[model samples]
Target: MDSLKDVTLRPWPAPKKEELSQEDLLVKIEQLASERGHLRDITEKSLQEDIDAGKHIPDDTNDAVKQEAKEKEAPSRQERLEKVFNAGKEMYGHLEWAKFAATNALDLLSLVLSQDTNKRNLSTFSQTFREQGLNQGIPFGSFGISKENHEFHNRKPEELQRIQELEHKQKVVAQGARMEALDSAVDEILQAAKQLEKEVRRQTKYWQEIVAVSDQGWPLQRLRQNARHVPFGVRYGLPEAGDHFKARGFAPLQMDKDGSIILDPALALKPKTFRVRVSIDGKITGTSQLEVEVDTKDHSIQKSIQLARDSLFEEELYHEMSLETRQLLAYGVEFRDSVISVDAPLMGSTSHDRKLLIDCIPREDIVADSHHHEHDWLARNVAEALRLLLAHEHSMRLYRRSQSPPPLTARTQEQAPPPLLRTLLAVFRHLEGVDSLYVCLEMVANTLNSAGLEVTLDTTRETSWAILAESLKEPSKRGLSATDQLLEIFRKPFDGRATLTLPTSNGVQFESLTIVTRTIIGQPTFGTEHKLTLPSSLTSDLHLFQQLKFSSVKEVTSYLDWILPLHIAHRLLKSEYSSRATIKSHDSGITISSRECKRGSAFSTDIKVELLEGKLKATALTASPLSETEHTEQSHTWNGGHSSTSFKQVIQNWVG
Candidate 1:
């Protein structure tokens, strides 16, 4: 009874208005709708502003908007939602563009700074060398070799004349007729550097002003503090010490917690105590230590380190300059025994030697062959570095050329054909006669057969004609289908023999031939050699195959210098249908593949060609199989193939 004591309850608050007239209810509804509309407008504007500012919006905001639209079933609400999302996409695009521009600006600044430093160092080296009387010129004897035995020194007189002409042209432009051109170039570079610095300062100030006005603290100061951890010349975007440095005998000694690179002691060229003065905006800012080493009691440490660093920097600068200069001069330049020698072409036909002397500080004599050993390593390193740099330079040059508009002269000039196309055309012209064609085809078939791909020829010519027609529609089906068609025509195993009969004006004639040829084309495979029977008339053409054994694309072009028109033609054709063909090269050889296209409906064809032990080996793979009838038709068409004119057109459409 005590646990069941009565509990007090309070009634809920009465409704403000239980009932009202029609006019009052309408008025209340209108007021409520107006308030809701005002709130919706405020939220929409806020969200739009956030998106425009590249700020992330709360997911709940989106969910709430979507829920309101679902409840109201309003088409306008959905449309507004779409507009907001589109605005976000536009903001993202702007953000990406900003990032790209910033990155490129940093890279450009880094490159300019590095170049300035290098130029300054080079000027110092030249002054020091001139003062030391090292400019007398380097002699061939300094290279520990007789001048008469050197390849450049032994060049013909004609080559020497050509080299002189080239040198004169360069001197006219680079040194100027009055020696003012070099000065002008220098002034331009200096102006560019000043402009770059000014731009950076302007950008920094702009950001700083923004921070001040917004009362967001000094972001510039934060940036500067973070920048202190960045390596000199790398703050913007210089290449880091990595495999490239290591391969040149430089190794990392320590990696600081903040990611600073400390080179290995054994490989460091500069002494620990030696420092390079650094300046910014014409004022001394600080100093940079070139290396790290423990303190020593030896008093000559400073002198040794300074000499070493100077020598290294000079060598590197010279190497880079030589590569750049080579682009303007065709002469072969070599460095040996502190001497730089230029092998100029004499009279544009033969090479002649010219030398310049560079004086270097004598290294401490510790071992008998110490100087020789060190110089050898330096030379090797310079050579390798030059090779890589030149490759990169060439690639960039090509890219720039592609991006820029062509010069007026270039646009108006008639271009020459590629060597490969010219050579192919010449071959076709030489094999124009039916007898010649038959002999060549037999030889080609025998070569394929010997390489493990069986080949047969159509006796009736009908089957070959059909195959050729089908191949015209679908080039990819040509390889394997043609082979199958050849097999069907003979109806027997390939014996590397062919016979043909032709009706002359007066009587019928019989021609018999045996072909036993071996070709190295395609992927490497084991097989016995076949005795290739080339017609006596085609013996000279055999040299083409022999040359191809050692030929890369570039080598092939040079080797076929007499057939430049073909090469030019091939290049033009390749560019026109680049999407259908792919050509790749490696140390071993090149692989060329063609994709299936609408004209023909067969699979792709892949051909790999490489030189193996002085033999040109080629392996071809067909992507799909074909029926006997389709194969026969393709073979027949191939047999009746194109004339020289038509052949050229086909090549233009198909080859890359």
Candidate 2:
């Protein structure tokens, strides 16, 4: 079995006249003509059979009508048929004459070929042609027939001439008969073709509808371009816009199914001031009122005020430029003092941090006309512009920072970041969760870039500290501590940098966690070449002390002894405001105290813990005052804070 996929077929040859060469073509034509004659004879026989069966015959191949027609026109049709037969008889006579000529010519050729002398007789042949009504009353050759053969054969010249004339007459009659038959056939075919053409024209409309053709037959693509016209549809016009519409311009448009031409609003004239208008079905049906504006450009401040005269409308611009102006500013150009200011109505109780606009215009008279120099105009305008720019920049940065997630939302609905804060929050959501310190820092910088604030951080220091802080707060969150994990992820570059000091609300947190780590000689070791510290504690009041030094790692565990006790003394003195007398301490401590009126609150607190020398001074501290009669002592205990980890550990946990 041959499947469709498995089947293969040979290519077919193109149709060509050479497929039936001229000689073979002639034979096919003769064969078809013979077959046509037989078909005609069979058709006539079929008509006779119908008549015999008493069935009606139709004219033009209708059997029933032809039968009736044959009966009604029987006699006249027979008479006409006989006349046609007589015409055929005449044509047959010409054929007979041609046959006679061929026979006689053959005999003459035989006689001429047998003759010993070059002379022929044509007189008898000429007499025969005259009797057949073929003589032209001229010499043989002059009549386009040759008698010279007879002369060459030594026959009587006149006889040969007569034969030549008869042959010429026969040839002419045969040719005429062929021409008449051909002419009749052509006329019949042309009449039939005319009828067929009429039928084709009648059916063409039906086909055209089926094909979805227009009158002129242009197809769909041409119509989309509005180039070709279709009936039963209106022609759409080119769009023209003016001040009455927004974004005034011209565009090409087409009518929708609703018969309304929807003009693109972007095509409206004077977009800054104009509103859109829609024209439908040869009538303007939309809101027709035009948005009018007094033309002005030099003073945007005045123009903006006039444009937004209503308080409600003006309030929309409370600290920002108009929507239209903002759109215009998007056209790629840098500005030194392009400020957007809004004067919003104050909303009390709600912080205005997120509120967008502020008072924009100059606080004082911008132009002191008569005496003011042009430079003064620029200075005042530029200065006001600069101030606005700086203030907005500052607010924008703060707004940006507030946006960072996990964005703190107010527990009570009373507090929310201002509109700018919300906007910055939105921006920050996009900025947060960035893994790259550079990128996170860049986002921070970019958020403040437009403001006067300059942000600079040593990547080695600030980033490491932030990583360390995050690790301590949420160990499981960023998987910074895992087995061989930091090496598995990012290559740990050698960090020899020292701790950086960045300004904070509290003095400065060590920028590098390594500073504290190395100082404590923690498990995650800073190599010997790196700065290291000793671990020790002095008094019973402090729990721990970390030794610190430069890359010179040595056990100066003595520093812990000096530092811890002094810190403990300060903690103890916080509650002794009543004592003004000086007390001497056993270990190089000079304490000055004044008992001034004994005017401090009296409370009794106690702490109990021991401090061993270079091992661990897990101490606890609690303030105590001389209570009334020194009777009761309240106790307090303390625990140490969480410790730090290395950068490699941080990355391992984070990556994992």
Each candidate's root-mean-square deviation in Å? 45.3, 32.1
- Which residue segments of model 2 deviate by more than 4 Å? 1-263, 269-355, 358-656
lDDT tens per residue, model 1, 340-368: 44321112122332222222332331223
Question: For each candidate, what is the lDDT?
Answer: 0.36, 0.34
Model 1: worst 10 consecutive residues (lDDT sum): 232-241
Candidate 1's TM-score: 0.14
Worst 10 contiguous positions by lDDT, candidate 2: 234-243
Identify the candidate with maximal lDDT. 1
lDDT of 1: 0.36
Candidate 2 versus the native: TM-score?
A: 0.16
Estimated TM-score for each candidate: 0.14, 0.16
Q: Write the per-residue lDDT of candidate 2 for residues 163-207, one digit (tens) a residue.
A: 999999999999999999999999999999987786566445433
Error of 2 at 271 (Å): 3.6
